[model samples]
Target: MSIAAIPTIKLELALQSPWMANQVAITRNNRLFLGLPRYSAEFSTPSLARQAADGSLQPFPGNSWNTWKPGDDGREAFVYLNSVHVFNDETVWCVDQGSLSAGVFGEQYSKPAPGAQKIVQLDAKNGAILRILRFDDHILPPGAQLNDLRFHGSLMYVSDSGLGGIIVHDLENGKTIRRLSGLSVVKASDKAPPAMLAHVKGGTTFHPPNSDMIEITADGKWLYWAAPTGPLYRVETRILRDMTRSDAEVASQVEAVYDNNFSGGCAMDSEGNVYFSETVTHNITVWSPTGKTAVLVSDPRLVRPDGSFISQDRKLYIPVKQPVNTVTANGKSEQRFNIYSINLPRHLDGIDLGRAITGV
Candidate 1:
């Protein structure tokens, strides 16, 4: 079914910070989870603050949700985490860049120990650290940084957008694979510009280093990836999981699945439809196997739509930032941002592709 128009209703989810909003995810129970990558300080906590089934918003204590166990001294922190995935009702894993002074840690005097990039697996229900998979010694180079991640079953695939490329991790074996270090994928006609091309306040541009978004097929056979400043690429799960291949050999096989330069994060629904923020045009684009490319939303109000999620109710929940015009729902335009819940003109009834299929 082709959607002629998307019905987006703007809610007043006014953001309190100006950091780069990354990704968002909605649980089956309507619990809303979001991520902020470049903020003032590491958000040491996480929770579902959305309105509950009873129509009441519940605010869990900051220390009660996603967090890190402090260093020896309570003041020394351990959280430059960015993206998170809530799975299996209780498991929640978050990516910690390890470089404590990066992102939200900017200019803060908190010193960080060398080699900190790691993924923390937490019990969402209890906020307890189930396991800490540090990658600095495994995947990242001496000065590189780890950014976002997505999980499937026992394996977690991460994107090292900082030093460029993707990192494949084996949770059970504590093994790591760093594929396509500096160049994600090379092509003869690839000339897409970076997604973060606009300048915001304080003369800041959204230029990131490497792959920024990663998604896995429901049955876990394919991994879709893209960078905020590079080409969109993907690889088969079998190649990624092979414990015998050399990094250079794996790089030789990495394929460019999509060439669109998605300036923002990419969202994939149950039906395998890929949605990406076309920052260059202030629009959202959806790509499907039918070889169809359609603009899902193009409202001027959708300035810099970043981390986004599609709910069971078929709603596209997006966290918007740095509006070109600062106008509210009422026509007053100024510079402001908010997290919006938009209703898709089409339902996701056909999104389930059943058992994931392999991708080139």
Candidate 2:
């Protein structure tokens, strides 16, 4: 079938804030939430926060869960929280990497506080606690840098960027399994990360997190994922959920489907088309369910499109974090961030991402 003509998408600045953010979760009711990995944080910085009607960023539920200083017992709050999702439009799901936090200069590869690493679910309407899922040492390495989250049926998937692999958690059985661990395909490619991450050089230590961003098709059968410096890869959900399958069996199921990568974040539409936010080039590329790829959007103002969301109302929301521009490279004295939204092409549909997200 021939592709539709590219629409003249209007890029609108939705909001601007003082903090840098990478990922965003939008509820069906239109609540906006954003997340960021703790980079150069101060005492009041929140890894996860909500944007209010007044345009202020509030620490998600409250200050308690968001607070974590170096020596403070981080067991109860977000230690290195990053990824967030509005699952089923009814609840909020957050993945706490539970490990490294911002050090004096940059992100530190340190041991996670006890009981800090976990996946927490909350009631979307009231921000009430729903459930918390924890992982064992065997599944998560001591230096595990958990990155992103995706759901298909009863399974919740997380990527361990610090290491290399996909973590699968069964909601029904409360069991967790690891797949594609230590595989080169999931590990960070030697090629430099695009956008602001590429600015580091000469004495600045840098490492690209592996198996970081992921997206699932509407049917929940295939998962497309990649590292920061990437060529996207895909694997069947069945191979990942089967407890009987060995790690090697799951790894064998992976296939490299796209080459032009290096994205900081990614999202999928109901038709199984995956949208990649190329941080380096400030472009959004979409790969169809059938494996064809195309440039969806290219806006120079989208400086380091860190994380994105495709709302139910047919809009692609992007957060321009401007990582290197504000932090160290460009040497800016003041720093602020902006979020943008573009209209999504109208479609009849294929899969309901909602049902895929909840596995209902």
Candidate 3:
């Protein structure tokens, strides 16, 4: 069933610190989790936080977890929290990209500190740190920015936006493998023009350097990904899990799924419908299982929808960060950040695809 028009409802407003919200994760019980990355000097908020009933930003777990000093270990504190993923098992996984800022305005943006790049798993109920996984320098280089991630069974696939490629991690053995490094599909398109937002004074370029958005099918069979300025592509998870396959062989298995404009984030529902936030167009586009693309929602206020979350109740939550506008405004971002939610149709609701298929 194709949705003709979806109405967006304003969920929350970030009046305290505008233009700092990045990602939103809603638990099964309807708890909201927000991630704030320290992108500019204007915003000095917690890297990872949760929204209280009164709409206040409380540091997740504790204040020490969000505090970062010069000599602190990046593994212990939240250096630069990028994305947060809450799974069906009631565990929250936070992705620390390590980079201080996106380096959009200038090269002086801070770089990733030691022990900064890692994934932390937390208990969703009480926000307790369950486990932490750090990648080696060889697998995940110092300059590599670990972007979004998706899970299929015991394996987790992470996108390296700074360094073009995908890093596969084994949850059981803690081994990692990097695939399709420097590949054209995984890297941002040089031919594609820069993305411009309407609210910003001057348009800012959005060359993500590598793949930044990713999504897995409900059945856990296919993994789809794309660079911020490149076309969509997907490959079978079986091939990605096959350790015997060579990089060339794995690259051959990747198939171009869709040719789209520059986008910020992408997600997939249980019904096999894919959603993409087209920052240049200021709209969210949906691609159905039968290979049809349609605009789900379009609004001028959606200035760079960075990360999206679909709750079990079929509500799509999107955090409007407006990164381009913030950078173009020279860190004096006047626009207010907000989290919007739109109820999706029953046919488009998200399910535990991994659990449904594997019966875990």
- Tens digit per residue, CA lDDT, model 2, 1-114: 322224376679887656777778888778888876666644246777887878787877886777776666766777777788876745888888776633333344366767
**Model 1 residue 35 distance off true place after TM-score fit, in angstroms:** 2.0
The per-model lDDT (C-alpha) reads: 0.57, 0.73, 0.72
For each of the candidates, the C-alpha root-mean-square deviation to the true structure, in angstroms, is: 6.0, 4.6, 5.3
lDDT of 3 by residue, 1-360 (tens): 443444543333333334377787877776778888776655556777776778776778775888774446776888778888887776889998765643432443357666778899998778888988888788886667888888877888899888788988888888899888777768777646533322232134334547888887767888888887767888998897788998789999999878767777877776566778776777777777566666667788777777887877777778877543344346664544677776654432222121111102
What TM-score fits each model? 0.73, 0.86, 0.84
On the 0 to 100 scale, the lDDT of residue 1 in model 2 is 30
Clashing pairs in 2: 22-307, 153-359, 195-280
Candidate 2 achieves a global lDDT of 0.73
lDDT of 1 by residue, 1-360 (tens): 453434453333533322344555566566655554434343333322333456443432245333443342212223455665655544556676644432334433233355345666655444466777665544677545676776677677777766666777766777777776766452212344533445342334434556677777766777777776546566787886676876677766777666664456667765567778766676776766454556666666666677676666677777775533355688875443366665665543333222211211
Candidate 3 least-lDDT 10 residues:
351-360
Error of 1 at 309 (Å): 1.9
